[model samples]
Target: MERILFGDNQFFAVNHISDEKSRAQAIKFQNDVEIIKTLDYSIDAGVHTFMCTTHDRIATICDYIRSHPAKYEDYKIYPCMPYAHKYANAVTELGIVGTIKEYVPNNFMGSLFKGGVAIMSKDYLSIMELMIDAEMKMFRNIKTPVIFLQNVITDLLLGLGMTEVLVAFHKYIRKKYDTEAGFITMNMPKLLDLLEKAGVENPIICTSINKAGFRMSGGKELYETVLKTRKVRVIAMQVLAGGAIPPKDAIKYICSLPNIESILFGASSRGNINETVSLIHEFDKQYQYDILSNF
Candidate 1:
């Protein structure tokens, strides 16, 4: 069945850490309680699939997914585990039942991470063919690496791999255009080449493009360049900017972007979830924004 997978990068509910009593509750619960609470809220909000980050968090998340009867029946969970000693526990833990997916991020961050390949569903491949050439044009003067996970995983799945997980996922790319000064350029062109070379046939490659906190100053320029070169699709994130952007304003700003396909926000509380959903729906109903003069 075709599914519109919604990657929930930051789904942990850390609301209770605001005050003493809440802080105490948070201590008692650790991150697991908050995670469970988040799962409940996300399920209620109608998220079809989740792309979880961190290794240690994946087990707790999987446990919650397994325990929740409703969520288990409806949604899919893909946990991204970075390669570090801290994550060993989650990776080797027993009783996983092979239901949740496990993935890894590639060498660099931005469009070249291994994480990119894991989420490339079949539908994404169909969309890439038309956009490959255009995507290549965007990085004519840039140097970076690109790889797609869609074709990479086909063989593993066909071979009946032990787990549904795909390790070595790349999400973003970093280029040392200025070594002494230290500036990282997101190598979009290299990524497209890798996807094409790998035969990563996916119509849409969802990007976790956060707009609030960590932003690309040339977002529209990059988007337009890439869009002009290839068929482009983005999953806008960090609308709250790691709590920097106010929820209301964040929603408003995300709603204002013309290129965004979906603004996937993280909500820990039912109220917040409701607010976000209402905002998206409300904004969609009256969604109108002029391409800024900057773009």
Candidate 2:
């Protein structure tokens, strides 16, 4: 994983703080060209990895990336799968059978009639694998070194005591996609406990880690303790607390922490991208200096 990961929340109008900002972003990125341009800005600012949801629009972006191989030769995308809204909207429009027919791979279509049987038999692991394969279709041939399970599913599984499904996802991605499996969750402490208990060692987790305790389940102090003690690789998201904390302060706080392997953030413009990247680098240097001084 890159030390700094560029996120897609801005491109998809996912503002955590202001509805007005979300609307504005929706308007600004209505075109794939504008989205590509902003991504170029991030690349120019030296952030190569794009950590994004597997939204419908992302397939178009993948198409564009596929078209321009030389320009994005080193660029990577961390695809967060099963974009919940996509499935919800699909169910509303297409219904269950239609949705399954549309998403399930052609080769796997032979088992379509067994869907009801699978559901009745509680073969959820098989269903989960099928869904993962379906969601991964768009990212085909893209350099997706890390595939993330979205928080919507990760947290739900945690609440359901379905640690086995989590383990299945982790193992499936490694075995099938040949990539590292990452989990995005709001409740980091609980998820880590479950993953560790399931015998998953040094798992990759992306979660909210900010100064304001914004969406940090189990509060900030617990998260701090987990970070210091846990062996997992954490990619800190929501570090700005929806723009409540100053950029420098947010980056400083994250950099001061232990086991934070990366920082994930979204920005709409080159200026914001450069500023955030610079602040991360600045604070990271300071953090290393403080560590060396203590030594």
Candidate 3:
């Protein structure tokens, strides 16, 4: 994972703080061209990995990246799966069978049969794999090094005590997609415990690690303790705590943490992107300096 991973929340009108800002962002990125241009800004600022949801518009971005290979030769996308709204809207418009037909891979009948059998036999693991395949279709020709389970599903599975699904997702992605599986969750401590107990070693998890503990489940102290003690690779998101903390302060707090392998954020402009990247670098250097000084 890159030290800094760009996110797609802003592109998809996902503002955690202000509804007005979300509406403005929706208007600004109404076109795929605008989204692509903003992504280019991030690339130009030295952020190469895009951590994003598999929203319908992302297919257009993937198409653009596929069309211009040379420009994005080193770019990587970490696709978070099962964009719930996409399915809900699809089901409303196309019905369940039609929704499956629209999203599933080209092996239409084969996948549908498998999905049906999985549903009938209550083999939800197979259904999960099928849904992963369906969500992954748009990212077909792109360089996706890590596939992620979104928190909407991850937390739900956690609450349901379905750690088997997590293990299944981990194994399925490595087996079928030839990529590592990542999980995004709001509750880091509980998920980590479950993953470790399930014999998943050094799992990759993306979650909220912020100064204000805005959306961080299990509180911030437990998260810090886990980071200090655990063997997991954590990608910190919501570091700004929905604009509660200043950028430099937020980055500084995150950089001070242990076992934070990556910092994920979204920005609509080059200045914001550059500032965040620069702050991460600056604080990272400072953190290393402090460690060396203690030595």
Candidate 4:
């Protein structure tokens, strides 16, 4: 995990703070070229890891990255899978069978068979695995060291007491793809315990970690406690608390925390990228010594 991982929320109009801002971003990044330009700024700022949803536009970005080897040689993507909206749209447009046919790779008929078995036998793990394989198809030849289970599914599985699905995702990603499985969730503490019970040791969990509780379920105090006690690699997201917290204070608080392996954020401009990266580095520089002393 990099200390800074640029995200793609801004590219997809996922402004958490304001509907007005989301609409503005939706307009600003309607062009793929604009998205690439903003990403170029992040790469130039020494942030190579793009922790992004597997949005359709990202396939274009991947195409750009794959084509520009000399420029993005160190660049990598941490794919957050099962972009819910994409699936929703596909299902609505194509219907169930058509959507399955469209997404399932290679053996369409065989995938239908598998999909049938999964649906009829309630073998959802098979469906989950199929979805993962389908989602990962666009990322071929790209370096993806970590593949995240998006928070929507992660929280749903957690709420449903579906630990096996979590375990299956963790094991399958490592076994087949040779990459780490990162689960993004709002309930970090509870998810950590669930993952540990499912035999995932020291899992990489991404969650909202900001000065304000914001979307962080189980609250910030529990998150800090889990950071101090658990052997989990946490990628902190929403550290600005959906624009509720000041950037300096948010970065300072997160940097001061015990174990945040990476910080994920998105910005539409070069200035915000530079500012946030600088704030993280400065606060990290100040607290690195203090943190090491305690260690």
Highest TM-score: give the candidate number: 2
Better of 1 and 4 by TM-score: 4
Which sections of candidate 1 miss by over 4 Å? 1-31, 67-71, 83-190, 193-213, 217-220, 224-229, 256-259, 288-295
Of candidate 1, the 10-residue stretch with the lowest lDDT total is 176-185
Query: Per-residue lDDT of 33-141 in model 1, one digit per residue for the tens?
Result: 7766766666676655554433345555565555655646756543222213333444476322111123222222234334564544433422222222222232233
User: Residue 159 lDDT in model 2?
Assistant: 100
Q: For candidate 1, what is the lDDT?
A: 0.43
- Looking at model 3, the pairs that clash are none
Off by over 4 Å in 4: 89-102, 105-122, 292-295
lDDT of 4: 0.89
Ranking by lDDT: 2, 3, 4, 1
Per-residue lDDT tens digits for candidate 4, residues 35-66, read 99999999889999998898888888888888
Candidate 4, 287: how far from true, in Å?
0.5
lDDT at 293, model 4: 88
Q: Between which residue pairs do clashes occur in model 4? A: none
Report the alpha-carbon TM-score of model 1 versus the true structure: 0.49
Candidate with top lDDT is 2
